[model samples]
Target chain A: MKPSDKAPSEKALVPFVSVDHMMQLIHHIGVEEMMSGIAGYIEDDFHRWELFDKTPRVASHSEVGVIELMPTSDGEMYGFKYVNGHPKNTKEGLQTVTAFGLLANVETGYPMLLSEMTMLTALRTAATSAMVAKHLAPKGADTMAMIGNGAQSEFQTLAMKAICGLKSVRLYDIDLAATEKCAANLAAQDIKVVICKTPEEAIEGAQILTTCTADKQNATILSDNMVGSGVHINAIGGDCPGKTELAAGILQRSDIFVEYPPQTRIEGEIQQLPEDYPVTELWQVITGTAAGRTSERQITLFDSVGFAIEDFSALRYVRDQLEATGLYHALDLLADPDDPRDLFGMLQRAAPGNA
Target chain B: MKPSDKAPSEKALVPFVSVDHMMQLIHHIGVEEMMSGIAGYIEDDFHRWELFDKTPRVASHSEVGVIELMPTSDGEMYGFKYVNGHPKNTKEGLQTVTAFGLLANVETGYPMLLSEMTMLTALRTAATSAMVAKHLAPKGADTMAMIGNGAQSEFQTLAMKAICGLKSVRLYDIDLAATEKCAANLAAQDIKVVICKTPEEAIEGAQILTTCTADKQNATILSDNMVGSGVHINAIGGDCPGKTELAAGILQRSDIFVEYPPQTRIEGEIQQLPEDYPVTELWQVITGTAAGRTSERQITLFDSVGFAIEDFSALRYVRDQLEATGLYHALDLLADPDDPRDLFGMLQRAAPGNA
Candidate 1:
């Protein structure tokens, strides 16, 4: 339908999905199921990677943090996310990160969906981690160590359990309360939860080591000495410059895979390494163009600093789900005038005195 | 407060405002009055120009059109506008341009307001034109020749009358129906509407000449022969590369003014001039740091391409007005959690069988 086709009495509006609605969707579908669906979407898009128009996020940095806009499109649909990173936010009783996004139809250049992405980001990030683990982790992997239990920990644990089939999780965090809270929250789940005293203790005998520390520094949570053979590392934190989880020696010994090499080279754990260092984009593995987990004895690392395209996939998935469920609220985000040229007339029609 | 504190309960919530709400606000407050108020805000911000952190807009250009993000801040408040330009859109019954924006408190980096700017853009553009005319146009300029009557023409004409005190308007458009529609809309108002056959006839004896045509190419709407001494030219349509209104000869003869010279040099009529061509920024004129209309007989030109700060001002004004009148509905745009670390719990709370 054209923008000008609407009669004065007809109102064609955009739809908005609130955070509450998104949470309801997740709860109803189950986080595990949601992550699996999102993972499938990401994998489907990754296989057709060349169709996208990609760019490094545009960032505005300040002393305490950075705010950025990440936009990507595939000719027909355009999506963008507004996100901020402020590591000190936790100390101030705020989140270190929060985000929202919009998905628009490129044909009309009109916003079709506006969504709360903060929760979705957590879900997508965990789902992405599991997608990497599926390809990079050794077969029949069961035990996993989660270093740095924070707000994102439970989601990661559940996604791994649901998507990667992990059965046991050992948790460690510098903040004991955070780890305790995480353990308490997951107590009823089928999987085992171990509150380890130290990072070494947490990693011992684990087939997968996931590092998601919130420290805004190059703290080596996983030393080279602690990692064993045939381990898969899902490195989620150390996503900004000067923040890293693994020691340089660990990277040297592992097969490092990344999401969007250009961005990961600047923001991921590999930021500590030289630009020419070897790395592989995960899409290659998903598309079967490159080998993943070459041998059971090899260490595989997925250094993921979130990318825009994944958000695009998540937006599309959420929009589709919301439409199918008929749970979203409609919003007048774009103007749909009776006569497209007479936008001012909308004001006149809505005028209290005139009506 | 903290993003973490707000993360869990409202992890994926974003508030939205529809075009209806925007029109509601405009109708509640008379359009003439809103234009006057916006012009005041634009003038106030322009006077304190140095306080703003300004940058040239970031744009992604495709063969069909261009999409751009314009961001600016004044240490305390930050704002950005997402806009697109596709001259061919009207033929497909879509707006030539559409926009939306957000205003955030810089100290907290929390978005305070989100708005649909398609309608607001037309209002702000008109307010900006009138703001420039207030400083550069000759005193008591009653008649304005508005070339290219389209979606933007009505707002421009109304704002000129309300903010710049123009009593009569002469309308001309390539599509006679568009000009006829614009004249018909203004017939109820106090101002006299004159429909002219040609640009020359429209420009005859008019004190201010406004060129707001929708063409995306370099089409000269005004030539040196049509413009006489002392007449003020509000060049509005020629805002992108290869699009211009005044002939190079006209620009050479007039005392030109612009908004952000670096951007105007690329998008404004001055794009045709040399890199070293002398021009005064409108902010300088607003602040009284530069001369405007040096003599009643000296021609002055306000080469308006529209700018981000004006939108910032307009957003702040609309938000404040909405809040004061209780006309704005609260949006759950940001996620607010009871316990920030319990983001995963939110999903469990929303689980299938849970209330």
Candidate 2:
């Protein structure tokens, strides 16, 4: 290939960060510090939330699962993520969720970054929960109850410790092997890891309760009586229709806060409540327009269905890291002809012996 | 990176076709033959159009341009194209359009193929035009008048020759250099090329007419009086909201056929007509449910705004070609952990020394 405009040069190469590079970048920055940095970006974006073009994700549903496209543009840049959720995938030795994302420049509509977002999504989801809890959780809240010790449990536990000063996490799962796996994964962390036998015991004396079960159905991981006042509940697994983790009784007692009420109403824990139920937007709380944890007895619940802006924030954070760490390879994704109208000439020239 | 299930393995790597590889593949398969093959696939898909899940594209419009995601599924396979259009990019030595696409399995929600679609889009669009012309053009239409000699002109000319037995092409463009470039690119082909100085001379004695100008505004390259009866008009440039190439009178006088009614109504030549204006879906014509060209004196117009199914067909065809050609490499796109529940464990094991 020539160094002309038709070639895959700097103008045509899109920087791609693979799973290996993503893991190395995570280890380089340290998982906790990266999550904390992503939390900062999310908070900054939240303060300017009105400037973003917000829409509910475009979803394609099938009998087995759903594929979704989450897109947002902040006037200057555009970002989108492609993710799928097939609960039965875990049974097939596959991840229940796998994703990748792209970020593009608004002015030229040229992609700037393409990244494997499955790991990045996990980091962003946990960072978001912890970031919201930092605003809504009670003062000096240092202990979190992490129920549903699956893929997301360790990240959630660590984010709480890194972002919200969570000191200890009590883990519980119906599958004891999953709990054992999570406990083993977290054995080297600084925080205390407590293995609980039941969901009630997992929430005992913890000011923050995080539920991340992976069942694709409405299963009550937390009952109304198990949650105490002044506790912040970070619900993570109730991300799609017919899959909820908390009972309606628990939702009724907690003062709910959500990211994008329209989406959370359909896919978040708030889906169980009435359509017009009053819920404070977490952006408003972050922007100081709405109150967060007004008193010790105030029960604040961050119903996290995860939003496009949070993914956008995480993508933005990773893109910023690429230049410094050089953990990326360029993919020749775009066809760039020297003369814009001479694309056929370029193709003809590329023939064997023609060039 | 371990192969014990949480690393980039055969399950995680999506086959990628870069621009360089795409050019090599095109040369390997020959452009005209590839277009003819894609045409066959398009016809096959059109015959079963009712089985597809079709929707209008999701477009994010900016001041300078627009980026769109076009997705479709056939219950077995899912496909989507990411394309951007920036008309001003040409002046800055950039492509007006660039695209990439992906094909995924609907059952497992894992990507199977990731391809650079800028060149593929060109092939598919031309194939769709020529395939429709085969069904709608007047009998013995061996000559075509190609107006607006931009990036798509040469492909249209070649496709007509390859698919419809077109023997001659009369080319006219606002920029004379674009026409010269197209003619030079087609010199090796077994067809007669005639360069016309004006649109009137270009359409003289031509039975098929194709308009593919790239202006973003509504400028009529072909007026009503210039187009005579008994000719098929392939309109390709009127694909976005404010972009059109034909006069309203020309649309009124011809029997219009479109890919999808809802999308064509907003983005095709039919946008000039009344909201209740009657038009036929081209799939119906392809499947023998509707008439194409009933009489030699009747004028037919294929209002091809391009559809997702045509791209799906192209992607499917490419995926089928990959195994035999081996013109592809894998991108470590998906995060596949051996134990689906231990994503954190996968990450922890990916550290430099830990692995």
For every model shown, what is its TM-score relative to the native structure? 0.93, 0.98
Pairs clashing in candidate 2? B5-B337, B5-B338, B6-B337, B6-B338
Q: How accurate locally, in lDDT, is each candidate? A: 0.83, 0.91
Task: Show where candidate 2 strays beyond 4 Å.
Answer: A1-7, B1-7
Give the best candidate by lDDT.
2
Q: What fraction of correct interface contacts does each candidate retain?
A: 0.42, 0.80
Q: Which of the CAPRI classes, incorrect, acceptable, medium or high, describes model 1?
A: medium
Worst 10 residues of 1 chain A by lDDT: A1-10
* Candidate 1 residue lDDT tens string, B162-252: 9888999999998898998888878887899999999999998899999998787888888878889888999999999988988999999
Off by over 4 Å in 1: A1-11, B1-17, B274-276
For model 1, what is the error of residue A63's alpha carbon versus the real structure, in angstroms, after optimal superposition? 2.6
Worst 10 residues of 1 chain B by lDDT: B6-15
**Share of reference contacts kept by candidate 1:** 0.42
Look at candidate 2 and tell me the lDDT of residue B272: 85
